[model samples]
Target chain A: MFFRVVLGMVLAVASCGAMAALQIEITGGINQGQAIAVLPFEQPAEVKVDVAAVVDADLMRSGKFSPLPRSGMPTGMAKDEELLKADAEVAVTGRVYKEGGAYQVEYRIVALKGADRGKLLGHFKGAAPLDLMRQAAHRVSDRVYETLTGQKGCFRTRIAYILRRDGAPFPYQLMTADYDGYNETAVLKSTQPLMTPSWSPDGRRLVYVSFEGRRPAIFVHDIFTRQRTRLASYPGLNSSPSWSPDGSKIAMTLSKDGQPDIYYYDLGSKQLVRVTQNQAIDTEPTWSADSRSLYFTSERGGKAQIYRHDFATGKNERVTYQGKMNLSARSIPGSNAIIVITQQNGYRVARMDVDGSIYMLTTSSLDESPSVAPNGSMVIYATVYNGRKGLAIVSADGRFKANLPSSSGEISSPTWGPALDK
Target chain B: MMLMAVAAAMSIAGCSTTSGSGAGAEGYDGQGVVTGIDSDGAMTVGDPNEVQTYNGPESLREKNTIYFNFDSDQILDAYVGTMQSHAQFLRNNPDAKIVIEGHTDERGTPEYNIALGERRARSVARYMQNLGVDVGQLSIVSYGEEKPADPTHSEAAWSKNRRAVINY
Candidate 1:
């Protein structure tokens, strides 16, 4: 449960003032990735947010590059040979200026004289409002990532998480912000509790459990329209709503039957088809990448562990055995691995292969509710720090970790939405 | 006649009406509060114009909350008397309603903790029904770890958080 102090956050009529976005601090990381140097961008005085710093931090946080620090940066701008001499594989230099009251940045990434010598990966240009310099920087980072790795970049995506504001009327707020935890806007606020926000594939709507009417119910919130539809309000538990890959149906945990089990609620007909029927607790239903099967956490074996339910074959099998308890699992897109909260000496986020091999991905003792980024490069989980719950992100390989601190109240159940169209 | 009798009894006791059962019978629209028990350990719900009382053990008022061990929903023997008092009160007042809010500490996964919390609340609801409380009179809600009675993460806070609170 969250910190249940009375925070008066009435949503129906009360307006919410914007609060400071979460400040992301990389808590732990390894400097072993490919070396890269980002020169301090020459910028107009109107652009306040550091675009180069944002790009540098993005590459560093991905655990894929070792960006040279400000001290290691060359005076003015370094040439391709100087970057090679500095042991850097790539150099990024940029210039920012103002055009028609908007800020514009032009940057170039060049590979050093090594594997791909003097390769101008791309010449990129980005523009935004003077205050939205971070978005412009993130666009540049996405282009750089795609150019280097040949994979789509998630830098331009948004993440939605539950923020428990510590005031009276409406304490729980569903917030969506940039992937770096800036430009936060409240999606919904209520005096009651909200949990487990899952984004639709298009990132246009979110499904989450809310207790606005003093009961646990699943709601689908349209991100743009602010319209909500109550999808499930069974007599008992109607929690853990996850959209299918096709967005045609939602697999959720419902206790309207005998026990809490995974049930698929079709959006068109609104018919519920039970997926699991054991007396044990079968909850936290997440769809596989292909939407052919579901991975859920069940206590049917007497301990909380992950089990897979195939929709086509009706086969149910345990997928995790390396931990005493494993729950809150999500299938990492574009891979055969699924990230889960596995308990070893303590609960930590781990990557479990479909064949039963497990790779621990976090160092925190009390990590839970892991959500893999749409690109499957990073996982976000909630951890307790200084007696308060905060959001933390770790590279899928467990090499780099970052923390996003929300001083308002406890943050929980973060879901990384799909990559947006920039 | 019944309203006058209940109001006279409330006046005699001079009880505070905070966290009490609502005003029952005769359309008396007044807020009721449950206060300290009488010398005989009877629980009383006092309204501005009426009072309803239930006979129970001295600890019944203090024992409305049933605490549970970690990941358990079994009711202990010590709280049986308190629950019986609650069941008897419901039987005496069929119009009275109650909500059992099940909660858990911040230990297990949230979805499972939600099921665990519901099991705890349902356990209380079933026990009260077996003691003659109608099923229609009682409803259950599981807060899981989402609403901790105590915010600390220590054992003290956890023990307090894992509980079924009987709300009238």
Candidate 2:
């Protein structure tokens, strides 16, 4: 089910980019996608593995191009000439072998007929259980996308979410895994409870809500160090801690002011300034790319909707009105669009042009908490699956969809980290 | 808040109900605040200098607990009526030390349940404080949703779990 959505997008992408970027034979109908082939990989001493099929699956998810199947290739042509005769604009070839208890794989892209001919676009060597065979494929696919279209691809990004375990009493933990739902790791844990796992801009740490001592408090945990520090413990309520773009401060919702309202706390100064004084439920704060304005959901208008608050002017404006309830609003980087969860006939997540045009993402699901990737190409959010709460990610244009598929009991409230600094 | 409301109503209920009849318990249960009855149905609640006392009912010995609504930290309206007796007992015994533990059901996010639990505990603490218990002497801790008196996954179990127990 997930593969099909992405596969459809791969077709759309291949056509769009081929028409705009490549001066290929543009037919009366949509360009029938760039036909790409995967030549058998080079074998290193002692390691013999070819990962052409994995690359095929990776690229097809982008709705970009259809890879000529392994069975379709006639066995005799030279690797170079075979790709050329097939009209393949780009070719993916890789080498995989095992050494020192780890798998090493190198991915490459060779342009068949273009200005940049036989280009060694990308190379990655790593260990396995990793879907290395698959990621190796995505790396090559990304290379082709970048080499021809000149734009970065988000196939390698990972998402972090909160999951409840099935142990004696529920254990809520923060989990981080790849976009394809592989290689998962627990970021934080709690016996009392945990919610809202948000990633730092640099992807080095996580900030989330925890009930460690039976009080709703926020903790900042360093992924590498495995150490955590309490950031807030107000007497009444402290929640929805969100990081500013520059990672300087966190904007959150605190009810210590007699009612739930938006508040901004300076990470450096240790001072908190109440941002929203309304007596209504105001929460789910997110930052604009520049950190100049804050977007959040407030029920001041009688129902939850997206609103913008400018720090410089101390003025506010309503940004979403099409839905009766627009709880989560996250701005996609480099685009004027904000992914928000709207409840019209039913609850669903949609990407809306900051002004108002909405592109519905999930058709049937109880979706909430949408977080846009740093690149703004995809949005990850929380929803229920099989009656088990979980997280879902989809391309910004709604071309691809995937569930984090946590082994833990259920998952929710995911926030995308800024790209990994390393 | 509902807890405080409980303590207030308990005091009001004391005036309406006649003195209770129970061995060694009536004095602390249904009695008034100023002059408390001892276990013998005698005034045990004394003034500040005398460790002031009140006569409580024997029935209250089994009812030291309070109940909360589903997904709510707010004390139930029924609690105010019963808690008024507790406020009277506290007034009668100024030196008595009491602890309130807040709890919640298994539903909702854990963080949310914890917050809801604290509010429920505070509700009781505030009520007691308003009814003349020294704020400094009263201590409150939120157990969040950690310990449940009943382990059933049903709403019945959850309602019973969302509670604040007064321990002296």
Candidate 3:
């Protein structure tokens, strides 16, 4: 009942800022999701970030929970009876307060009905500077989501993407932001183009393709230190740099030898090992969870398709045969499924199981560059929105969908970073 | 006089546009001269026997960019004369270095588009090499769909975007 009403008000109010942050627009979700109430956190006028709203949006984006609107929420700290009356299965209440020139946020997830009625499921408190209030709020969401869903929440994780602002001094920017599209910071800016950013497993650095000198070169950039090391600047096209799961090597597509083929650069030894020997276009190499094999898109099969290259056996096998073209395959964490851009009706994001069954996730025609969340619960991709390119998110089940439209220029090649250490 | 007559006949044959496949040596009329305007009304003609010297970008008649079909990297027959003109210019002036920049329409994955763009550029570079352009004069880069000649999302714009630009 709450979700039915909330569906009418799906678009969240856009927050005002100097740099317009990505506004979350929930398009669809499953109707059977657990109904939860996230009350507005009690905070002083000086504190700007809404901790409860962030948590609510995070849960809603997960597609496992339907957050009740504030209109349905009872006034002033709803009790268990009030929550039950509002059809909320669970209630998240929180407060943000200042302490010693810093901001601290405290939140509690309370069960409303069932055997665990009136029981506190989770209580989390985090502190950060005023500027990092959104991050602190995301941590609260992470804890609350994990406690409720029994799975690690990706709210605390960040997303790395390329934002191209035409005519700017540095048109292309490597950006990092909270999963909710807040706290966007440019990690690297370039006059030429930057694309295909792959996050290191440690979430501290990013390996991406930058055309800084009017040529495609792979660079490993430390997100915090702002130090850049050119990994591959081979003669021809050098692009599609994917960090291995173990963080020891980076698999990329290089044309120095001949056509674009998969090659892994060992960070420790600085040796480039060829993965696929095909003359066809072999690119977009994504390491498996174990880092023992690579899942890459190759045209060796006559058309672009997903292929698994086992490093130990030196064997290559085609993984996808259903789509007209399947490109940019990324292994989903904790599962045998991989998210990729498949061309069926048009280029759309889809999840392919180990058995080779394809499940379309997004309905957009021009969707590309699908990056699965660390938890594999959602996918972020680049798509055309109203003729302008922007990023979007969809639940792995294709139930929930949200559009993250930037305030200005186009955004593409989004890669969700790994979960940060607690 | 015999070589000039043969070159003029080849340029006349290149103007036929009947061969839709990859153009062979007959498709290219060398000597930095592009004769006979194509259907696009975008070609320039110079004396086939003049032994045209490479002056600058103006010498190539501004025919540096070549487009491809959807999801294709094959050099169209229409662009063969343009490639021949560029090849002649590069061979005449080995000191002139050019960057063959590849691109694609805003479809498919960005990484794949990068590969496709490179394929387009490589196709152009190979075409020039076949026409005897020095390898040292050509370097290739792919912008994929990032730098579009036209940013519009329609088929016309994508045709313009799916191109390989010869930047001298």
Q: What do the candidate models score in CA lDDT, each in turn?
A: 0.76, 0.61, 0.77
Candidate 2 stretches with Cα past 4 Å from truth are A1-81, A84-91, A96-138, A168-170, B1-168
> RMSD in angstroms, candidate 1?
10.3
Q: Pick out the ten consecutive residues of candidate 1 chain A with the lowest summed lDDT.
A: A1-10
Error of 2 at A384 (Å): 1.2
Model 1 segments more than 4 A misplaced: A1-21, A75-78, A99-102, B1-60
Q: Rank the candidates by DockQ, best first.
A: 3, 1, 2
Residue-wise C-alpha lDDT for candidate 1, range A1-422, written one tens digit per residue: 11112212122211222224345666665466778888888887766767778888888778787787756566434566665665578888887887786777888888885668888888877777776677888888888888888877789888888877543234566778777667666676554678888899899999999876568888897878655677888999988889998888899988888789999988889798898999988999998878899999999999889999987789999888988889988999899989988888777899988688889887678687888887888888888866778788888877778777664568888888888785
CA displacement after TM-score superposition, residue A19 of candidate 1 (Å): 7.0
Q: Model 1, residue B126: displacement in angstroms?
A: 2.0
Residue B158 in candidate 3 has what lDDT?
90
What ordering of candidates by lDDT runs from best to worst? 3, 1, 2
Fnat of candidates, each listed:
0.18, 0.03, 0.40
Worst 10 residues of 3 chain B by lDDT: B12-21
Q: Considering DockQ, which of the candidate structures 2 and 3 is the better prediction for this target?
A: 3
lDDT of 1 at A203: 92
Q: What is every candidate's C-alpha DockQ against the true complex, given to 2 decimals?
A: 0.12, 0.04, 0.17
CAPRI-style quality class for the chain A–B interface of candidate 2: incorrect
Q: Candidate 1 overall Cα lDDT vs. reference?
A: 0.76
For model 2, report DockQ.
0.04
Model 1 interface DockQ: 0.12
Q: State TM-scores per candidate.
A: 0.84, 0.66, 0.85
